[model samples]
Target: MPQTCFELCAGGRSRGLAEIVTGDGNPRHKKVLQQDLECDIVGRNPLHTACVLGHSNIIQEFAKYNVNMNEPTTRGYLPIHYAAAWGQLDALRTLVELGADIHAVNFLDEIARDIAFRYAKHDCVEFLDWAEAKHALQTFISSVQSAVTEQDKGKLHKDEKLRCLSACKAKNDWLSNVKNPTRQDLINQKQLLEDTLLPYLNKLAGHPEIVKSGKL
Candidate 1:
């Protein structure tokens, strides 16, 4: 008789489970792995179970199987939340790299970072904080890129356009080369954009003459 799904998981046979579920092993076992097993009575899926076990290899296999990384359990705890709560830093990092929503809220309205803090998982907390700031910096960079494109299409004065272009390019270059930026680095960059390029672009966008001419 073949070992059961629960048996395989309990033994940490991630490779065997992957092969069975993906049909690389006995094709009949595929259906067995496909059915939900109630996830040890906690409403977790295989992916969530893998996260709780800190089995990042299993998580990667699940991702290849198209499992929803952000799927919430019955109580609204996402895989990220489980990883954070259990102090599974590596598992949490794997989830993040696999596109898990860092901002996802649990039933208690707590984010993964909040849970990490509550559980005294300082490493996970730091990683989540940095990830959020990096996301914000990336968003700001995209907006600056868009603004530069729009400025090229606008009817701003030659001097104004040159100034904006230079500033945007310098900021973009600096941000691109930034490595392991702290929160303060992110905040300062945002402040610079708001004070300089963004304000100039906003002024151009709101200018009555530019708006009337449809050149903003």
Candidate 2:
């Protein structure tokens, strides 16, 4: 019965697709298939403990077994989605090659790409660019605190200077990317970044290098 299946799935060293489907496969994939088993079946849980503990090797083993790569859970995430958010490039690539749906959304209505961007996970961004997913902007917007706000005295100007430098590299950054930036928008997110940092930036405005740095 399904109860037997659930109990078996909940308390085994490893379970296979056949076992899961037949109420007689391995129970936990935490070990057995670790060498090389249908990891898609074993490593199926999204952002699960298995992914966090040894996804790098687990991903490779799954490849050896021809496990369904990038198979989406009910939450619409593949193993790759979790690996990316956690900065596991090797696991991420394995999932991608297996054709994981890069654009899949999570229960929160936010997609993996958005998770990488909002959390400053740059490595994940490189692969997720084409997969950019959007929730209602308002839902997403409400989750962030003031981006550049921090209260350390010596660090505010330094933070602003970096913000300016980061923006300078990307023309759109200076003209518009941070805070809805675009060359035509012309609102000066640099100023906005500094404003958030103002509690600290203002204290350094009178300093020569700080002013010249435009940190204030």
Candidate 3:
């Protein structure tokens, strides 16, 4: 008789490797790993660990076996995109060095940069910005446009206003320390700063909380 045990490796709990690489890993992975490059493994195989456990180390292991680091996930996002979105800076760098195509439309870079910013990982946010701009992807750049449009429509909230202000200032300070940002990136930064002013101005104009909080 032969072994027949297998384990699931979705984004939820899949550590990324043990289920696929480890010999003692899930038995079903053997066939999946052997699939051709064009196979639909994203939904079928696991992408969770592709950018995990230190982007550099995991990518290292993949390189040892000549895995396609640039391969897209089930949703069309490359492994670097996964690394970017998940705050895996080491992983992001590894994929890049491994020749992962950074210019591709990666939803993870857009989503992950925001996630990193929200968590105050300013370095990663800046890296994503540079990478996107260098690659001319315009993914994160478009997000700035969308945020501006929302603010101009007066559809933004208090927290959103604060976040925009922070992002704007941070973007400016970051640019001043590096090579000059493109006109588009700088323009977007200015717009974000201007957008922050509106909500604050509106609140100040009618400051209902001023009388209630007693701290104002």
TM-score of each: 0.74, 0.37, 0.40
Task: Give the number of the best model, judged by lDDT.
Answer: 1
Candidate 3 clash total? Answer: 2
Per-candidate Cα lDDT values, in order, are: 0.74, 0.46, 0.52
Show pairs that collide, candidate 3.
Answer: 55-91, 85-112
Candidate structures ordered by TM-score, highest first = 1, 3, 2
Per-residue CA lDDT of model 2 for 127-182, tens digit only, reads 55522221112111222122224344344455565663453345433333446323
Where does candidate 3 stray beyond 4 Å? 1-48, 53-55, 107-121, 129-216
Could you give candidate 3's per-residue lDDT for residues 148-198 as a string of tens digits?
A: 445445645757655654664575466657575664665465455445444
Q: Write the per-residue lDDT of candidate 1 for residues 47-101, one digit (tens) a residue.
A: 7777778888878777887878898887889999999999999999899989999
Off by over 4 Å in 2: 1-50, 130-216
TM-score for candidate 2, residues paired by index? 0.37
Poorly placed runs, candidate 1 (over 4 Å): 4-11, 36-42, 144-179, 189-196, 204-216
